[model samples]
Target: MRAETGTRARRPAGPGLISKVGIILVGIVFFFPFIWMFASSLKPSLEVFSSGGSLLGSRLEWSNYSSVWTAVPFARILVNSFLVAAAGALLAVTVSLLSAYAFSRLQFRYRDRLFLVFLGTLVLPQEVLVIPLYIMASRAQMVDTYAALILPFAFGAFGAFMLRQFLLTLPRDYEEAARIDGAGQLRILVHVIAPLLRAPLAVVGAFLFIEYWNSFLWPLIVINDQDMATLPLGLQMFSGERGTDWGPLMAAATLAVVPSLLIVVAMQKQLANGVNLGGFGGR
Candidate 1:
């Protein structure tokens, strides 16, 4: 009996080791680009192009960072990026939470059908909407303004869907108890449910922030002024009409990526908890 038990334990242990190895391998594969970008940012322009140095061989040339700053209005771009991202995230989360609550807890005629219509928007690519959205923005005289960038993405179907799914998993007991105590819907949502929903809200906010931070397409189309351009658009100017300057380009890329990386690292635990907690409730 003892020998048989040992064999069963050892069999599962073999697969566990294999799974760990596979996960490590995948992580390395995914992280390689960022590693390379950091390394390249440290290399001189000539060294960056040269194939001779080891990935970690070159001494860190910190001057590339200074050169990058001088090469572009990175500070302004950073501010613009921050504003757009922050505003978009705030609006998206606020709207999504309310919408999710309505869909999950409150019932009205054709609610499910309305949700289905909202979800159907997810099927269409953002590219298809760009031209029409741009035209509408032009008509509204919002083309060159921050409103042009922030308003379009303020509410997203994905945010609504994800938050709704998360909200569905929560026990109705808290809401019922709140009502029994004479708490209204808004009061219950603000005092009771919102506090409990923090994990999922954090997850949603983190994702929306990252998405807005990295957005390049719509900003490029609408924002023509240098002062209003986001980091991704400003970085494009560095390429020039001649040839790409790799060192400074890498430097700018590194700077642009830092906020997103930090946000992800900070919220990673919350994101995981949100997803896990959200899994408990059914739609």
Candidate 2:
């Protein structure tokens, strides 16, 4: 009986061990791209694709990063990327929050219909908007301007819809209490509602940041000046029509991943909270 009980106790460990092994395998699969990029960044241009050696460089070319930066005005490109992405994200989030509040809390005629129309825009491919947006910008002489990049992404229907869902999950009693204390709409939204909104707002902001940060097509079409080009354009130029400088390309690509990683890490706790509350919505 002692031996039997010991065997039974050990049986449960099998599935637990299998689950851990599965998770480890999944993590390795997901992390391989990053590993490859970092390894390739240190490789000589020719060695980047060589199959005979190990995954990384046989002799590390550490100078690739420095050389690549000096090859062009990379700092300027990075700054442009940061400015356009950050400005677009902040503006988008602010507009989404206000639109969400109005949609959730206030009553107006044809409000639901208007919201549905907004949602309809979400299903439309962004490619469809390029020509019309370009024409408007061209007529306004806004092409190649920062406004062309930032203004187009400054309002997102998806952000409003997502934030509206989150707002629906918040208690009206909180707003009622704020109102009873003689708080005005703007005051209540600022102090009472905004405080509770951080997690969802972070979620929305993070998505917007990532979207605008990686934006390629719109900027390519609108921006003609080398001075205003973003990181994507810089990377493309690095890989000229003749051939790609793989080592330098990977170095630039690795550097490009930093801001997104930092943003996600900084907001990870709030991001987790937002995801946890996703089923019921959150604010």
Candidate 3:
């Protein structure tokens, strides 16, 4: 017993030197692609994909960013992307929160059947629906407009289902208590439920933002004007029948990656907390 206690007392304290080195190596492994991307963006176009087999080249090309700006409507594309992604995420989260609250809390006729019907929409692929969506947009004269890009994708069945499941994990005590205090449903939802949902909702918003930001096909089919193009659509300018512009393309890609990266970093704490707090649960 004394020997075991002595051994326990003598145990090494913090992470040793080798452990720190191992952590650094692991970090490097994970971040090497990002580092290579930034490095490649700085290289000259010719050196970007050269057989020299190095992450960097002899000459750095500061002009790539300038070239990219002049070569395409990068500013407009960035704005369109920012607007579409931000608005789409906001609208989707709003729809999700409201519908999920209703489905989880309220007593309504055919609620279960209607929810099942709503969930059924998830099985339908976007590709299959785009043709119909396009025809509808044509009828509404919404094609080639921001509404065409943002509105169609704003309300997602997946978001509703996800939020509903998360709501199910929460206890009903607070909601009931609020109801007993002469508060209406909206008041309870806003004051009681929304506070507990901050972490999970942030996580959902981050994911929806990323999804909308990186979207390609729908926007491609919807918008024909160059000025209305998102970053993904703007990528076509970098490629041609003859060849591709590697340096500027890399720079543009790096810029496109930054917003999503910032969103993830900003919401990382909420993401972790939400995941710990039964992020996934449903009856």
Model 1 lDDT on a 0 to 1 scale: 0.87
Of candidates 3 and 1, the better by lDDT: 3
Q: lDDT of model 2 at residue 199?
A: 84
CA lDDT, every model vs. true structure: 0.87, 0.89, 0.88
Q: Put down candidate 1 lDDT per residue, 140-184, tens digits, no spaces.
A: 999889999999988778888887887777789988998999999
Note the residue pairs that clash in candidate 1. 169-281
Across 1-283, the per-residue lDDT of candidate 3 in tens digits comes to 9999988876754457668889999999999888988899999988887837698788788888888899899999999999999999999888889999988889999999999998898899899989999999999999889899888877778778877888888889998888889999889988998898998788788888999899999999989999999999998789988799999998998989999998888888998887676646656
Please state every model's RMSD to the true fold in angstroms. 2.1, 2.5, 2.6
Summed backbone clashes in each candidate are 1, 0, 0
Q: Which stretches of candidate 3 lie over 4 Å from their true place?
A: 6-30
TM-score of each: 0.92, 0.92, 0.90
Query: In candidate 2, which residue ranges exceed 4 Å CA deviation?
Result: 1-16, 278-283
Candidate 2, 128-148: lDDT as tens digits: 999999999999999989999
Q: How many Å off is the CA of 276 in candidate 2? A: 0.7
RMSD of 3: 2.6
lDDT of 1 at 232: 85
